[model samples]
Target: MTAEVPTTPPGDAAATREASERGGLPGAVDPPAGGGEAHAASDSALARVVREESGRIVAALTASLGNLDLAEESVAEAVEEALREWRVRGIPPRPGAWLTQAARHNALDRMRRDRRYREKLALLAGATVPTAGEVDERLPLIFGCCHPALSPDAQLALTLRAVCGLTTAQIARATLASATAVGQRIVRAKRKIGAAGIPIRIPEGDDRADRLDLVLTVVSVMYSEAHLVAGRDAAADRDLADDALWLSGVVAAALPREAEAHGLHALLLFHRAREGARAVDGELVLLGDQDRGRWDAALLSEAHRTLESAARLRRSGRWQLHAAIAACHADASSSAATDWLQVLTLYDMLLRYDRSPVVRLNRAVALAAVEGPVEALAEVDSLESALAGYHLWHAVRAHLLRLLGRDAEATAADLRALDLTDNQAERRLIVARLAR
Candidate 1:
């Protein structure tokens, strides 16, 4: 999620401000707040704090309140309160604890104010504030959001918004949906959870297997989005990818028998091991062009071991196929030495599991390497209707066209690819290719 938290809605502004003045932060503050400059600084600091600590704060609130919607609303109120109160009184020494406490207070207030939550009032009243150890409630929240009862769309939207703390727009962009659609999906999902009384706790046994698929999907989506970062705030992108990586590792540890979990961990590790070579001199580097020497050998080895372990569980999935493909690249001495036939075989298996246009496009590239441009061009052309708006599709078509000595068509395809993307690094690479 971006560091910038949207301002509180108008209805909650007064309540949040009131909550702030009533000792929201850790330190006691005298009334009569500071000037506008101090307010601005506090707002900036609050944004940073929220971005860094939002997951833990929201997790704790959800665990205590047992309502995803209430937890989110209360956390928003607490953050709004922090923006105002921290301006007058400097940020608390224990910011996470302060946010948790403030959120807890808001949750209690919500319970008392709303008749529907009267029953939960007793629960809220007895809820003890978590210390340093109990703050990480994200895993529980993840399981709750991805419950089997909810549709896949609901699972994805809720997990991204609630567990990952991503904004609607970020979720929309990552999932290729309109922001309004994503927001509506989240709202509906939360409503269903509340109406159905879905407990906000980790599932056990067979229930865990059902939910594990959804959890792996969420993590995989996050990891894939990292590749599209295109040098736009590389540090933030890396942090997000690392978060996905960490989450996958946690899943693998949690479910030792789930082969897909280990497979996902392996897949993410392979991708992460090559992150350094994805860009050079501020230009996006294609996988074939990336410097293999820059890849992390330790990570590569771990990926191999993890994939092997997953294979032994007698399970096969898209993640396992992807990891195998990555291993093929990692084991190659250079691009020229890459096992295109083996890579093509992996893509074929992946296509059976996932026939999305993007997968087809990638498989076409492998086909070009293994068969010939003529056959690959046929496959690419068939996907035009499905992937016309995807920049990478056009870019791949352009590469195939160039290989076939169709310079004019290749140039047109390259221009179309450039028009589809606003990412600066991507633009540079496409422009350089056009120049050639």
Candidate 2:
């Protein structure tokens, strides 16, 4: 959903400037090499549940035990155990419940030795297994992690680790920081959260107001990461798009009065509506070429209604503007029917909230649609210094150059994009472009 038209960028150590400019999301891990390693990580239900449910399991444990580190550590232990046990025994009927129970037991075992966590163990006793009545605390965990007491980088790192289950190395690569720095950020963040006695629950009143955008940003980053990984079908270890949609919906429901929350939901839905049509038989389908009929009409209708609801609140934010832009594309009868002018205007407004080159690069796409490739080329070229390492930047540049009949330059740009991209689908598309 991200980076195809303008598409999402994959961040790494080389992405120093753009990493800060874009949200911190690592490139997808390449598929495992062979045999048991592949089966454990990919070819099993154990892998699916761990990918989808680990964050919520960790969040629920953190809420029950009131210890972030222990909850996360215990969940990790439970997953390791699952990797070993689930293969021999097969997946349990209720994987989340099973995981929650296993993680709780792991926590109790660890806490029994700690002695200091006796109170926590005592508190954990009543809810040993997950029940239907047990509330999902992932939304709360997300808000609590984004608390303003932590620095912005620390906040991003902590949320990605706790809520998204990203490794410190992955977060560091995306943020262009050392693994040590990311480790320090997470350590200090946990300490600050514990010292300040931050509750494992959603903030209320003005506190929610201050952190809502940050929370949505974190959620969007999660979806972006999911979208990127989903594109790499060979390495598709997790189908996090459903989880991301559910989390965004939960956050939006939890804070109904917040326009941006609904806006974020609408933005995601607009993308989801067309997701099924994104690829066909292992080849990436460009937006223009994809069958419009394949887009989910129900989801598109709901996204419009949601966007309209957001408008009625009269509280405009960047997310709302983004939804409006997405709406423009969704409403078009065909790619040629897309309202590039209104889309460009929305990007204009988006600049007020974020002037990052990623946004500018996306805006250049609309610029090409409305003003022709020459103007868009200049715009894309301006962002070269900041986004040279990002594959989509060159991909977009190649598109514009090819449009302007600069074949040699376009070939060179496509080759550069091929070098930078790790996603198999995008790489194939670039290879196709070069062949043309």
- Taking all chains together, the TM-score of candidate 1 against the true structure is 0.85
Q: How far out, in Å, is residue 18 in model 2?
A: 23
Poorly placed runs, candidate 2 (over 4 Å):
1-43, 128-135, 167-184, 234-238
As a TM-score, model 2 comes out at: 0.86
- The candidate that wins on TM-score is 2
Lowest lDDT 10-residue stretch of candidate 2: 11-20
Flag clash pairs in model 2: 2-7, 2-8, 3-7, 3-8, 4-7
Error of 2 at 9 (Å): 3.9
- Candidate 2 overall lDDT versus native: 0.75
- Write the residue-wise lDDT of candidate 1 on 180-279 in tens digits: 8987898899999988988888889999878887788788776665545432522225656777898889888877889999999998898788878876
How accurate locally is residue 394 in candidate 2, as Cα lDDT from 0 to 100? Answer: 87
TM agreement with the true structure for every prediction: 0.85, 0.86
